[model samples]
Target: MTRKAPDAQTLSLMLDNVKFDSNGLIAAIAQQHDTGEILMLAWMNHEALEETLQTGRVCYYSRSRQNLWRKGETSGQTQQLIEARLDCDGDAVLLLVDQTGVACHTGRKSCFYRSFTEDGLKEISKPEIDPGQLYARPHKH
Candidate 1:
């Protein structure tokens, strides 16, 4: 059986346990719920965290844009949250999710597709789809 997430009140209390950095952001790592594959790493502010908890959709704060970025907003690779866990030190979070499509901007399954080989760094995973195709439309959210 799938575990139930905390409700609003409980979630609000749980937020108290999260330790955001001095920049008011925390690292949020996404992983495949069933396969345990590390998908991506992003940052989240308190509002983004609350939105994720409320909506069950992974939301992150983009450092470059300096705003909230909902995953797959531009692309179609959405992530459905299965579980959200705070780290032992409360400085980071682990998001167990069901990723619908490629998680990387390069159209790969994960951002960590590169591997360190005996010779040097290697790019192993190939893009399943063109990023330009995935992000054809302009992003609003």
Candidate 2:
């Protein structure tokens, strides 16, 4: 089915049904339209979700960092949001974004590189740039 952009009222109504996780979170999945390629999946708190809609930018709650973060804030591969949708269960979200560059923090175009196979797993994509070179200094081993 062709999903049209939801009106603000519809978006608000949809938000009410979302079931936040134990930590008051929901998973947000980003994807590219032309390719139907999933970019990355991250968590979002109520605040983050609202902010993302308000700003037209994808923002997610970083569990490890314990804060809200705008995707590509550090990497410069920011995703300009195209649309956001809640799944039937409302346990997850799907974001269509106009991606600029790499989407994964690993410097890959997408986070979903490892594909399961009968033999094992295999990488499907290569890094666009070295994370250390594109974002910040690498941690010392």
Candidate 3:
């Protein structure tokens, strides 16, 4: 399904309500639209949030690279924004998306694959695809 961008006035209001941290970043959680499975957690700055709202494509800020990180720019795991919701405190955002390929850089469907169990940390899910095959060049997440 195609998602439309919000009108200018609506966009302005939405932007104003978001409470970015002192670093000008907000926590964004991406989840599968249909299955309710959380795909990943990332940080988004104003630019990244605006771009995602306007283009219906998920974009994030790379804390490590100090730049905007377009999802699946290197890998074929792009996320299409279906819906976005801000928490009551406005400090975080929930993004319902259509994920293509694996969401995790480790080639897993979701980033939350590991679980803290009685037997130490255990990986609950296995990689569906090899990480090497996901990117054309060497990449760091």
Candidate 4:
């Protein structure tokens, strides 16, 4: 469903209801809006959550980098937010997004490229593009 950005007051109310973890971050799951395909899961701090709700772009907290990481900032694989939903407990978020290019650092369409089957863990999907090709330009931190 198409979603209009909520007004600031409404958004603030929504944010106030979120139950962030002790680390001050919440788990956010991004999915392809139309296909409902799970793309990736990431952490979102308060700033990331607010910016995503305001800008309609998915931003995540980079635990490794210790900074805010905008989707597609370096790889050109942006996730444009179509809608954002908080879980019943308000501790998790689901992002319906229009994904551009790929959503995985491994150059796969999604981070969930593996699956467990009767045979055991199996590689369900192959990388569409090479990581080197995706990050051809040097990224300056």
Candidate 5:
């Protein structure tokens, strides 16, 4: 069955019931429903939470950058929110999305392409697009 878009009140009620982690941060998981692909995981603060709901865009709190960020803001591979759900504990979120393009900043459909085995971590698939072509060159390096 399809879920009609919930009103703000309902959304708020849903949020109120979830158990947020101690740090007031929740884990948000991005997935592509059509392909059953797990894209990436990020943290979400309350502001990021509100931003994502209001914009229908996936936003997360970047631990490294120490700011709220929308995925693919610079890369143009935005994840359009199809649906968002909180885990039973309310400490985690799952976002079903219609991905605009590659979900991984590394230019793959998913960021979880690396596999760890006895030989250690390995790249299992070639990037679907060249990240450098889609995003500006990194300044840190």
Candidate 6:
């Protein structure tokens, strides 16, 4: 089924309601739409957010690279936006997505693979695929 794009007035209002942090960014969390699995946490700038809304693809602002980082640009694990939500304070965004392949660069399904236990930090999950196979070339974080 096709979804209707938001009108300009609606889009403007929604964008205005978001509260970007001092660096003109907001914390964005990506979750598996059907399973509710927390995939990863990233950051988004105004342009990235707008593009995600417009294109239905997940995009983030790469703090390490200081530029827009489209998810799965290098790796093949792209995220299709199922829904986007703003937190009550408007300082965070929750993205419900249909993720392709693994979400973490380490070849795991999710980034939250390490668990803090009495034994200290432990890796609770093993990589589903080799990390080196995720990207075709060297990627910056």
Cα displacement (Å) at residue 102, model 2: 0.4
Candidate 3 lDDT by residue in tens digits, 62-117: 99999999998889689999999999999999999999989999999999999998
What TM-score do all the candidates reach, one by one?
0.92, 0.85, 0.94, 0.93, 0.84, 0.93
Candidate 3 residue spans exceeding 4 A from truth = 137-141
For candidate 3, give the lDDT of residue 30: 98
Report the C-alpha lDDT of model 1 over 33-138, residue by residue, as the tens digit.
9999999999999999999988888899999999999998989689889989898999999999999889999999999999999999999899999999999996
Give the Cα-based TM-score of candidate 1 against the true structure.
0.92
Better of 3 and 6 by lDDT: 3
Of candidates 2 and 1, the better by TM-score: 1
State the local distance difference test value for candidate 4. Answer: 0.92
Ranking by TM-score: 3, 6, 4, 1, 2, 5
Model 3 weakest lDDT span, ten residues long = 132-141
Candidate 2: tens digits of C-alpha lDDT, residues 15-40: 79989989999999999967999989
Error of 3 at 44 (Å): 0.1
lDDT of 5 by residue, 37-116 (tens): 89888889887887787778788998888898888778778887888887776688999988888888789888899999
Q: lDDT of model 6 at residue 105?
A: 92
Number of colliding residue pairs in each model:
0, 0, 0, 0, 0, 0
lDDT of 6 by residue, 22-66 (tens): 999999999999999999999999999988988888999999999
Name the better of 5 and 6 by TM-score.
6
Give candidate 4's TM-score.
0.93
Quote the positional error of residue 92 for candidate 4 in Å: 0.4
Position 75, candidate 6: lDDT: 85
Model 6 worst lDDT window (10 residues): 132-141
Candidate maximizing TM-score: 3
Worst 10 residues of 5 by lDDT: 132-141
